[model samples]
Target: MTGYDQILAEVCATGRRLTRAELESRRLLGERAAETGVGLRVLVRQHLAATRTIWPTLGSVDADRVLAAVEQSIDAFAEGHERAQKLAVRREEAARREFIDDLLYGRSDLGRLAERAVRFGLLLTRAHAVAVCQGGTPLDDTDPATRQVESALVARFSERRVLLATKGGLLICIAPADQEEILAHFAKLAHAATDGGRVAVGRAHPGPGGIVHSYEEALHTLDLAERLALDGPVLHAVDLLVYPVLTRDRQAMADLVRNTLGPLESARGGPQPLIDTLTVYFDSGCVAAESARRLKLSVRALTYRLERVHTLTGVNPADPTHRFTLQTAVIGARLLGWPQTEL
Candidate 1:
């Protein structure tokens, strides 16, 4: 028989809902029937009833029996449309997730990226940056912050072009490059939502390959921001570029803190007085008077603290060479969480 007859036979034989074959047949037959000004539903009803009317006329079969057989099949087809629509929706969603996951994880093939890109209505070749929002834990598709970020970005930018995914307890977004304002905008929203958590934005990079680069940048940004305790609702990689290097060698960092500031930290009154004095002294550009004023201490007391620092560490913050070593040590100490966490 025709394509339509085969679809109907299969549905009747298996008692199945509308299959893909049936849906395709409906599309074609519906288009043909529309030429005669008949809607799909009305045409389908007429076609189903034809077996009854035509069989009686040809004196080959009972009208009632044929109508009953085909009419039972109508309900199944009706349910099939909804199932078909849902299936289509689910398939599209799955594909979009795959496209995003593969892109973020750098598993997407460059050759096939163009084809997959078009399927999602996105151009993978555009300049892009990845932003990661580390809010509360157990974050996923249902998280409110994630939902809000997705809604805000897509509302402003468009779903086809942006890839937003929440995995491994973080929300990662890949969007157009130079959208610094957009990244900052969402950062504030997440900040307010989490009562001030961390939001890391990476430097913009070029093309599809750039997505992974940007993702790496964002990850490093977040890591450094946490290590350095960098402030602000939105943290950019550019702001703390030097921090990553400082954090790279944990053993070296501990050694630096131990060798440089370790002596002062062990002073009679604990490290705060010396540490605070050193920090303010460094902040004041090695000016005795200004450092004393900032610390609300007399110049004599500040001098004494500086002398004590030199006495213990054997490096004066005033001597250019000694100051560089001491300053570097102070910074390394902070980054290594020294004193707070035992050298």
Candidate 2:
């Protein structure tokens, strides 16, 4: 091992605290590795495993004599060691972040990735799933519940083969397989911690490529939920796939609604009854009697509503082409939050 490695081993064996002699040696390393005294503050805190922490100060006191060359050398050694330690930590952190970014982006070499995964308790060959959670985690790995998720970076969830990190303002996590009940429970704890953080989970898939697929799907679910103004603490991609596909073209959707259903909105007061009538009519499989029964409207009134739809939209529900188009438009309307959207 190198001299620096030996020094670290010695430090670790020294227990919870350090002596004045040890501090003196590290101060020099701190000075050498740190660009300035200001950045050295961060270096010192990291050396102490505490953020923004400063060295203890003492009140003014009289000293008998000045320090000798040996004393000065000892002080420089301590300072330099501290600085070197911080620099080493920064390098390791950057490398780890790069690996995670590569894995998430599907750019990592599989053989190397698998080796790295093994060191981190991840078996990449197993089934995997991804989740994109919005917001920060309330609890750190010190809690036993999050121990399984805890990595050197303090990323975690619960008992599952999982990796976690925050990137682009989102908490991206990968877990072994998709366990709906377990994930749902995790969702509850997470939301409770943040008082309402949104989460999007993807279906589980096998192998490394599957992990990438899950992450993309989860991200897609989040985008879809945002575009559609959907609300829920946790949303699954399976539940949201249809809406995302249907609303891919908002302009086209708005235009279709305007040409097909806009007329009904201007009729008799507002669009509520017309929307309700159409929904019920379709729900009843275009059977006037069944729709009337469900709507609690007489068959004559239901027919009149249908007739009004035909007169305004120039599309009769009886025509298969017209019925299919109108039904698609209504579904689009709901997904795009139409009429209410002022489109």
Candidate 3:
């Protein structure tokens, strides 16, 4: 508004559109206002106020021409303002992305990371949990589905502590561990928004490094779900902790797999069908009928498969005494990717 009065007076007196230089100056002014956090409405109002002040000063002029000039000036100003705002948003987004990477990966000094977390409305001092959603299609922050989830979560929670991001084509949600509802709601929204993906939640952990651990746990849950053929759409790391312990000793698990089920490889169909029968049987709580139903096999056919397995492996699938060993070996085989990757 400082020099706008003189420009408005010129346009009113001459009954012409704003000169290129004047319009450029107006654009520059708009950019400055945006940079300084001025509202667009306020900027527009100032220009209109200047126009009103100058209107009386002009002895006689075409109202249409003066109106056109003012319109052009304001439009130019708005264009510049919007341009600057967009630039700012991009810069902020980039910073946010960088901070997330460092925070989640523990790539930065803990002190520095904690300070940066504060800027994003996160207090790294409290317990936090990470929930990851892996869908059929890869997703990113810019994806429409991602934005919708982000919007819904923001609208529902309104707590800045909850953050939604995408990493490695997976949707990630971080929320305070104390607020279990936030993570639960996020899992709900993410499952609905994504393409029938599985959502895994890591157990709550305390401190900044805990976030990294939780993120890793969530990621591992997805991996475990695939390896173990888990069908649940929502998985919690806590429920699957035993699997990790079982595989902690790679050699032990491998040896168990090799010794327990290795003989099945010699059976016709190369053990896969037998292995499937065993897995389904164990999963069905050793219920022959349920396992047969799940496998779409006749009861006699499933019984024959189980007998074949027992004959080949020399371990009874039905004996309560042998069930634990057989089940453990089956789990090990899945975890070690035995048949597919070789013992």
Candidate 4:
């Protein structure tokens, strides 16, 4: 209100509206106030007080003229204040986006990243777990569904150190390793808000690099779920650790798939139907009735498929000793996307 006092007094005495230059000066003052963290309401109150103080001294001016001048000046000031605030918000958002990208990808200097992490409510020194949601529709920061989850998370866990963001078209939440409930609630909210989606939680690891590891694990869990056609909507990387181990040696897994299930390709419909039978059979825990029910097949037809598998593969899927080999091969096939992927 440095220039505001003089301008208001002059307008009251002269009974004239502010000139364009005077209004522009007021706009600049408002921008400065906004940048310096002064509340607009507070500034407006000060202007009103100044107007009242100058009112009696500036004798017999046009009351309507002074009021109009005051209104025009305040509007210009508010417009400038809002413009400055909007710019600040955009800058903050850009910085946050950059920080998250660097933090998750481990692309920046660790010390720098750790320092930046503090600004975003993260302690890079502590262990963190990442949970990712992959749904039918891709989610981003601007999505209402994503914002709802973020708001819910912040409301319930405001004191906790957590960050929710979007990466690779998926919603990602990073939380302290010890705060499993945070990830769990994030998954719950994500499922509800997104209509339906798979949420994958990665095992917690220590330090900044740990976040990268956990993020990768979460992403891999989602990928594995898609590749394996897993039924569960929520997947934990720790529980699915065997998948990474199984796929560690890609060629070996491919060979196992090709060797164990290769013979079934000679059947009338290629290997897919037989592979499906084996998958359902193994998934059903050798329960022929359940497998038949799941596959919508008669018991006899299911048995015939089993027998056909035994005849072609030379191993009885029902035999306990052979079950291990067949089941392991079936899992490898699914992981490698055997028939569809030329494995």
Candidate 5:
């Protein structure tokens, strides 16, 4: 048996358990733990001294072996102690998560918890923003990818305090104090993961109490953009509000063609039919044959309309320059949401 095994067996035979208190007392008697605290080498020397006192008649090799066994025991004990400490920390972390869930969802006293977390320096007490990203896949089932993405984001924004969680297909992030920086970082990461899958981003909002508010706004913006078939990979909240204006403005520009070329519409028997023909004409890449087919008019009838349009609007229907002018007027009218007075 090893020297440590013999010593441990003897202690067990004594029928008195060597509690931590007893071990500390023995350490004090030899100043072992104290000297070791100063330096690990000092602790090794103290162990050697203790070994000689414990076994005086042993030969040199036996003494060295005994000392080595004791050192190994010390290392094992230290490792066990560290492992125990980590397990305790993990348990405390689990409890903290439970508490946070209760407080954030309003099941517990949030005010009290907030004050305590701030006082204990566990969390910042100020306002924060919540950003939710949908990575086009379930994060729970894809642990490795989720971890890789989370690690990248953490490394990229090490200075910013962020809390991340995964629910369903969403990667939820709580950013403290610097929402814009976090959002931009997330956007870049999402773009880099283009080959992985499509990612949809939501808006960011001020927090403390406004996290949900902002998260909802971002989700709504994403939904609107998607419904309208906006280009993606990165969808901004403001774009939803802007795209409609551009679309409507394009139609208004078409209206201006009919209004400016009024004499042409009158000859065609009505402005509306002529305007519809012109819209199809411009929208179909200025192809006279396509516009004539769409309007169910002969090519000759379409040509007459074009000539009248040129005369009234002082623009050639066939000329690229005048085509641009007609297109611009339609866009301006739509964007301005023009009434008769504005037109």
Candidate 6:
């Protein structure tokens, strides 16, 4: 029998449990075998050599029978070792999955774990904000430029401790600090990295529990930036408060719109047809025929009114840049109950 099997049988015969010291001694011997550049086969041979000494102390038995039992025990221990290795690997995988989930979902307890991980991995003591980056038009292209940009961000922000994940046309970044210098660095990187790109940045909140919050803010900012057609290489969360204002304080929005455009409303008939044309134009999706039909005027009259609008507002209705401004003004006016003073 193999050494392990013989040891097991001797324990059973003696009705005794091995001490911790004995286990340690055996483990040390195994390690020495490894240190000696011994293969498993050679290690097993050495182990059997030692076992031979112990076997004689037991009552004499057929050498063949002893060898068979020793072989059986060796097989059992190998099986046990393999099972242990599998369990260890499984445990590690589970931990990694749990870590990712916690980072995404914002668990309170997991927040602590995140802090520990960051401090341990990135040497960050505390973080005040997290910034997630959603790749813009140019960055969205699967190219070397994107990877280079990501690498640059990581290297530059190593002190700030940045984590980057780029997948499916999205480049997610987690920036731990909210310092202006750090944010400005990000903006500069973005501007340099992608051509005609856009970046949505979230506001800074308290760190530790702010990763998920920051992610949400980045998403919301991107939506707002896109809707408003804002100029960008960078867009901030604060710039998108107009939509929320429209939703929550319609009267306030209307007031602002009317205050801003009230003069145009009053001057519509006097060299400016802005207020009336805007009302009709927006209502009809800027369609000349529809606006003309609604206003009971010829398309020529509608075009004339639109020209006057451009002159008064200093915004060309046909330009994409002006379209966003017009939309926001129209929405704001609608929300605030416009035409404060009807003509």
* Model 5, runs deviating above 4 Å: 1-68, 75-79, 92-96, 99-107, 116-125, 140-142, 177-179, 190-204, 219-230, 237-343
What TM value does model 3 have?
0.94
What digit string (tens of lDDT, one per residue) describes model 3 on residues 1-343? 6577787777777776788888888888889999999999999998888888888877677888778878998999998899899999999999999998998889999998889888887899999999999988999988888998999988988955887888889999988999999889888888888867899999999999999999999999999999998988899999999999999999999998899899998998897788888999999988999999999999999999989988998999999998899999999998888799987
**Per-residue lDDT of model 6, residues 1-343, tens digit only:** 2345456566546545544544444455544544444455765675578567667665655555566545545444444444455565677656644654566566647547756555334323455444445544524424665677667766766665565544346555566564556666666666566654566676665545566676677777776556444456777776776566565765566655655565565463542246556767776787889999988899998898777666666777767778767667766654443555332
lDDT of 1: 0.71
Each model's backbone clash number: 0, 19, 0, 0, 10, 9
Which residue segments of model 1 deviate by more than 4 Å?
Answer: 1-90, 193-195, 248-254, 268-308, 318-321, 337-343
Query: lDDT value for candidate 2?
Result: 0.66
What are the lDDT figures for the candidates, one per model?
A: 0.71, 0.66, 0.90, 0.90, 0.55, 0.59
Question: Candidate 2: misplaced stretches above 4 Å?
Answer: 1-78, 136-160, 178-182, 244-311, 314-327, 333-343
lDDT leaderboard ranking: 4, 3, 1, 2, 6, 5
Clashing residue pairs in candidate 3 (N, C-alpha, C atoms within 3 angstroms): none
Q: Cα miss at 193, model 4 (Å)?
A: 1.1
Model 6: lDDT to the true structure: 0.59
Which stretches of candidate 6 lie above 4 Å from their native place?
1-101, 119-127, 136-146, 249-303, 306-329, 332-343
lDDT, candidate 5, at 51: 60
- Residue 3, candidate 6: Cα error in Å is 17
For model 6 the TM-score comes to 0.45
Q: Which candidate, 3 or 6, would have the higher lDDT against the true structure? A: 3
Better of 1 and 4 by lDDT: 4
TM per candidate comes to: 0.65, 0.56, 0.94, 0.95, 0.48, 0.45
4 or 5, which is superior by TM-score?
4
Task: Kindly provide the TM-score of model 5 when superposed on the true structure, using C-alpha atoms.
Answer: 0.48
For residues 231-334, write the lDDT of model 2, one tens digit per residue.
Answer: 78899998877776777888888888778888887788677688778877887899989999999999999999889889888888878978988987777776
The alpha-carbon deviation from the true structure for residue 271 of candidate 2, after best TM-score superposition, in angstroms, is 9.1
